[model samples]
Target: MSASLQKQNIVSNFRQISSNKLILAVSCYLVLILNYPFLAKTFSAIVNSADYNVLFLISVPVLFICVFNIIQSMIAIGGFLKPVLIAMVVISSIIAYATLNYGTVFDFAMVQNVVESDSAEAFSYVNLTAIVFILMFGVVPALFIALAKIKKQSILTACINRSKVIGLCIIIVGLIGFSYFANYASVGRNNRDLVHYITPFKLFDASYKYATRHFFSPPREFLELDSTPFLKSSNGNPRVTVVLLGETARAQNFSLNGYEKDTNRFTKDLEIVSFLNISSCGTATAVSVPCMFSRLSKSEYDKQIANSQQNALDVAHLAGVDVLWIDNNNGSCKGVCNRISHIEISPDSQSKYCDGEYCLDEILLTELDKKLKNITHKDTLIVMHMMGSHGPTYYRRYPTNKRIFEPDCPRSDIQNCTNEELVNSYDNTISYTDFVVSQVISRLLQLDESTGSQSTMLYVSDHGESLGEKGVYLHGLPYAFAPAEQTHVPLLFWQDPENSSFSLDCLQNQAQLIASHDNFFDTLLGVLSVQSKLYQKHNDLIAKCKGDSRIAFKQGYGIQTNEETK
Candidate 1:
């Protein structure tokens, strides 16, 4: 043969690959290339110089390779191999970018956030780094896979080969487990989140579970907690409770909660009282927001159950209080305000507080002013959802004037920025949030003075944020493994005493009590004085300090507990 012909023949032979070989090559590529973050984390978290530890480390990659190839053998068949692998490459690249840059885990909650986030919020994550990473790792590899020459196989031959691959993998896995069962169990028990760090597998598993629960399940029956809930207010002086629903504000960063930085300078001197120790239900808004509104406790909270029930807002609306939700955040109220009167402030809304991509939390105050001018009910509940400190665009959350912390991060690729810069930007958002909360208190006080009415301000963040702590930049780890920065949140309350019976001193005393999102529903009911069969007295933080028996009721007064119903 001629030299050029021989070279061409070699190239062609190298490019041609059978189905099983293709699956094996792709699985190895996934473990070694696309799953760099997972491997890096494993080495950092579990590797040591011990003999068994070294053996366990070596077996990790081998085990993953066998298992992944087995999965590919089942799914990536004759005509489907290229397309399926291309899709995996593309999606895994994106997931890998998030995991590498932000230490994100593609858990069920994170998947829900991605699936439900608005276009503006989603686009905030787009940047030069993401583009380069996806292009190099995702699109380029996908093109190679798509263009590869995959040899054909008959149905029977394919099935036999696939079964062989599966059997071999299972046997290999069993041998590894049997030989090192003690080490595996010890490591797994010690580092419970290690398995969740495995890329693509964990990501695919979570996506499938989310899809099945949200799309494949039968529609749950919507249950109303109370049909005849009544507002038991003092002499109807148009009681107004402005529930300032904050976003991404952690208690650890607040000066009111003992942080050295004066992040709460705007509201620190006001009549607001900060709850020193407050935990959120979940580490992400998609979970915590709906859970906060539901009557379910954190231990019992389920997304389907929360979505298919009458939340605190429903019972309050049914009790004759005019409820309005003004959302300035990028997302909706997660069905919390679906049954009530709600207004969504567009990010593109032509307002001074908006910059065409994300409106400042002050936009919520603009809507609040408009809602206050036209009060239609003697008792009202206004939920102002503030876009407070949502990141990696924390710099965009507040304006230039509100940049109280100097030398702040100004870019979206937050991992590249210094920790000091990131914290400064985040603290500025909190400072701006403090100003907004102070303004809400000011407006409520004005309403009380101008109309001889009673008004209160309740500010609670949906979930806390992670400011590059232990390499974790954003929220949404599994709740069992989430850090304090992602779970501990701030809760502030301010009430006008002239026209209302609730005392600020009592609230200040109660502020020291440890609480969680479980208190939110019953507390809202207590603040609005809404009498309902769904009211759980122990969960009502406000009623504990009301100093009245009517505000106090025994637990499980008007309804069956969730356990009983089950």
Candidate 2:
């Protein structure tokens, strides 16, 4: 044969594989190569532990390979196999990237975060390194798989071959499971989160659940908590509560919460009560924002249910409070402001505060100033949703002047930067947040001083960030295994002393109490003095100190009950 003809024949032969062999190979690749992070984690958990033996460790990979092959055998058939494999390879690569780099799991909430995130926020995760990683592991393999030719067989033959392969895999898996049942059970019991780290399996499971819940589920019925909420202010002073809903401002990074750094420099000097032990409802904005706003507690918070029910803002609006939601974050209000008057601060806004990608949170202050001037209602609640310390482009969150910490990580690929540089960037965002919040309080204070408007500023973060702690670089981990850095958020409450009825000392004392997003719904109503059946005194953080606490129904009109509001 001629040289060119021989080369073509060799290449063609190399590209061909039996259908069953291809399925087995893909399964092995997924379990071993693509899931290197999962294997490494499993090794660390099993072999490194004193309880597991070498035999048990060896069986773990074997068990996974067998199980994965069984799964692959069922799916890898006809014309669908290559396409499915290609999709799996590509998605697994992205999941692996997140898992290996950020220590993130593809849980349902993380899937929600991905689905709900805007293009700007999503693209923030993309970089040269990530592109290269995906190309090497995902694109190349996918292209190869797509181009490969499977040795075709008759329907009966293909079915018999698949059945044999599956039977063999099941047998091997059964043998391994039976042999090391005790070891597997012990490890599973000890490291419950290990299952979440398994590549493709956890990712696929979460994606399926998310799709079913969002797309296939029945429409939820909307339930109004309070149809006739009323403000219980006796003195008739105009009430204005600027609830500065923060984003990713962790308590551990705040100076007011006893952080070593002076991140809260601006707000520290102000008469603000900082709740040191405040836990967030969720680790992601998609979950936390609505959960915090709804009357549902963290334990009972469901996104669908929360979205279907009336939130704190709705109750405030019903009570005749002028409600305004000013959003600076790309992730809107997560449906928390659906029933209220809201304005999103577009990145394309013709203002210096916006830089075409993300607006500095100072825009929230600017909007608040404008809103303060046009306040017509006696009771008003303005929610300023801030993009505070959101990563991996933490450097972009603050201005240059607010770069109080030196040598900050300025890029989105923060893993390349040193720990100090990364933290410096994160802390600067917090400092800038402090400055922005202080500015809001200042504007509110000015309004109070001039017109005697009863203004209270509540600065609470929707969630916290994970800054390279245990290799986790961002938030949105499954809440059960999430680190404190991802849940312990900062909450600061500041009310104008001249126009306030609640004592600052009392609030300051309550600041030391362990509070959470559960207190958020009722506390917001308490700030507006909204009286309704949904308002629970115990759930309200400041309800104890308010003047109406001594009255009938504890100044509001509800008993503190754990029953579902509907």
Candidate 3:
């Protein structure tokens, strides 16, 4: 009797263990909603953007899945994945919307990876793998059916569950200590050093010199305030010169010059001078932007740093002229804003966590009239550099309503999507940029009515983007091999309609004349009528305006004013 009783007890315990295993499996399966780590980051980012519609849409499915999964687990049920599949499809639309509305770093990552590998086929294969993964996701439901028959009595729990635990452990260890492979076994104390870990090819930057320079660079005090006004000169009184130093703007997609789309509709009315031959010195902001302001060029940037003096801003300030910088970029790239009074147009609002997708490009223009009127001195120079066409997430670069094309990263990986979709997302951004520039110029033209002064708005992008053309998307490759698409950019200057010097007839001639950034220093000095020892008329736009004295030095692949336009 005792032996029989023990046998019964053993059988009962085995049954209970199996029953419990079934319950836990069902419960954990519900947790599968949390399993796809990528979805959380993507959804969270959209919910926390400038607009709030997406956040609301995601809540419903999220609620349904949570409740249904929990109840199904308690009931020891299965077959709820159909609804989950539907949920992903719905969520993808919103994700697609978010992606289209802003710029992402995926393309940059792809290109940087390709360059590091020196492999065109690597990118192509990486793209192929993403498409295969997406297809695999669609068939995952059928594959899970075998789980219904598997014995759950073992310690492994489930293969997927074990994998998650292992992945988390690896992530923690990686974050805590820089592995041996890390170029520097040190993480930064402040401002998290994710860029070092990223940035293609594992090459490390010691100081985050590029990023920090935007926020923490020792200020060069490049420009200053002027105390006086200018009297009438040869062409009446001096006019306002608005120099727009575009941030991360690529010219290959700019419509006014040669893009296939109508990206420059807003600027259509003003004088349009198209220069297809312009280019930038470097890709990284610190290396190129500050260098552009400094006396340094591409080859001389790093080496000339200490010896360099008298930047473009300082020269403008010393000439007894009012110089103001209206910025919509990341905080003057870190104190690059010190000397000039700046307006922060980059979003400070984090109402939505993923607000980086869309830009507040309109923010800088709001103060245009007030800033212009506030300039107490004559020969005032205003520099506005917008956050233009910068992206890996091209879809996130503009607003949803601005979307002019379809099938864009309607899916996540660009390679997984179509080329037309990529171009469409990019073209939309260009359209918005065109409108912003045009609106700014239109407003400037209207100002002459009240101030009784002449003004000119000059817009030039810092650099260009690749947009999957030549297998590149973003800028900042090693300058040695940066394609023409990355280096060649757009340059435009519109004289005050009322100014006597203003004439549309001169635009074609003005644009055709090759001009390099080398002339930027002297050209700006001449335009503002600033008199200084720092200023040399040896080669200036004004001298060219007086006669044809401008000289565009064709330095290698870059354009020039003359010199054998070779």
Candidate 4:
């Protein structure tokens, strides 16, 4: 054959390969932008925002086009285009379903929940609508890619095409980087939520970080606090402190804290002091539960550091106080109860309130007499972890008979329900929580009367929940941007009048004070009559009320402590 004929053959092969690559890239782009509604909404918002100029509006789409092309080209070179594309589609679809249904942002903590969630929590997301949505948008496109035909190319042709694809991808990525650098300050300011909306990439990136941190990273060595003197109360009565560690119970819905609904009907009637303004350490159980019991404040609290150090429970146990942890929530006490005696209420445990899915908070009180009998110590500390108003299945948290709020949202997919209905369902859970808490207080009162023990109860929620507020649902947003609904939690206190030295009027006055999880560690230390170097008098709300207000309240991540008390 002549040189002209050979050149013509090469040109034909190049055209065919280029066409296939273009088709694959375009297919990926279309599937992603079309199926992932959140991504499209985010892009639209970015373009329409005041910060977006004509250049940015054009560059953003072109940049993503480049990204898809790079993906397509790389897969083509490896001859795995079909399988890779299908896998991407399926994963992206599942993520899209979660984002759309739950109004979740796929941030680092949210991805962590996905990784650490139990089978029950994971299955809670499965429903007919979500399944059908995934089938239609995710699987159908994947099937099309799986069934698509591709032509084999010569090795020489493949090499040439791959080189071109690489060069083009480099140019496009460079343009994106340069554009971002040009408007780095403004882009950085506005793009906080932008990364969250990016499909597939954000999900995988977050998952990778979580996996690396929790699994791949070296195990951190546990650290014990320095030995210090633990002075018990001089009073003749034995101290019995009950700490109710609540889950997802926001103060916004608690009637005792001035909510419109009577969610705290049972607790409001009692002579307990309810702190009007108390913020959580973190917006999730994994962070707040541990942080509340640690010496560190929210800003100073690192998960690894918090996990390594001995928490309040450990300190109490070392101080010769009998520590008992009763868990109704499925989560372990996050190492806070490791040294203490822990009783996890199994589903098999017979109770009027327990079902296979979730047990009523009241179920935690069942057989408590037997558990208390086991502790032989003179001074005892009991921590009950309650599953309080944990959503998006708030209705399942309480018994059917206790559904006082009318027209409650019955669906587990809370975003689909009306806001009023959602609030009703949530309020019902709160009411049930009130009843459970009242029962526990009554039990404590009885125990105190019968045994002549100096009984005290403290209730503090781990974090708050977001019920379709500004299209954000559930908890675990980064504390920096998290709304008050996710951080402002309820803190309640009850002390046996006969066995306590603190004045109830002074406690009530301190109830209106601005406080947070920073105060929890020292406050608990003060309540348990444990005098140690670890305890900060300034950080102790109870101690501060008793005329030790020398230390100023330092503002931290979740709560503003500088505000004057009402």
Q: Flag the better candidate by lDDT, 2 or 3.
A: 2
* C-alpha local distance difference test of each model: 0.85, 0.85, 0.52, 0.76
Query: How would you encode candidate 2's per-residue C-alpha lDDT over 357-458 as one tens digit per residue?
Result: 899988887888888899898888888899988899999998888889989998888888999999999999999989988888888888888887777888
1-566 per-residue lDDT for model 1 (tens digits): 99999999899888888778878888898888888877876766556524347778788789889988888888887678889888878888888899888888988999998898988888888999999999999999888888778666788987898888889999999999898888777777777787787868798899999999999999999998789999885774788999989899999999988999988888877756789888999988889999999999999999999889999999999999999999887748988888999998887888998888888888887888998999988999999888898999899989999999989999999998999999999999999999998888889889899998988889999999898888898788888889999999999887764554555556667888999999999999998899999998888887866754322121212323344568
Candidate 4 per-residue lDDT over residues 437-486, each given as its tens digit: 89888887888788887788899999999988877788887777889999
The 10 consecutive residues of candidate 1 with the worst lDDT sum are 550-559
Over 4 Å off, model 1:
1-11, 48-52, 151-167, 548-566
Off by over 4 Å in 2: 1-15, 48-50, 548-566
What candidate 3 gets wrong by more than 4 Å, as runs, is: 1-238, 303-308, 349-358, 405-407, 410-413, 502-507, 536-542, 546-566
Scored by Cα lDDT, where does model 2 land?
0.85
Looking at candidate 4, the ten consecutive residues that score lowest on lDDT are 550-559
RMSD to the true structure for each prediction, in A, is 7.0, 6.3, 15.7, 7.0
> Deviation in angstroms for 104 in model 4?
1.2
Leading candidate by TM-score: 2
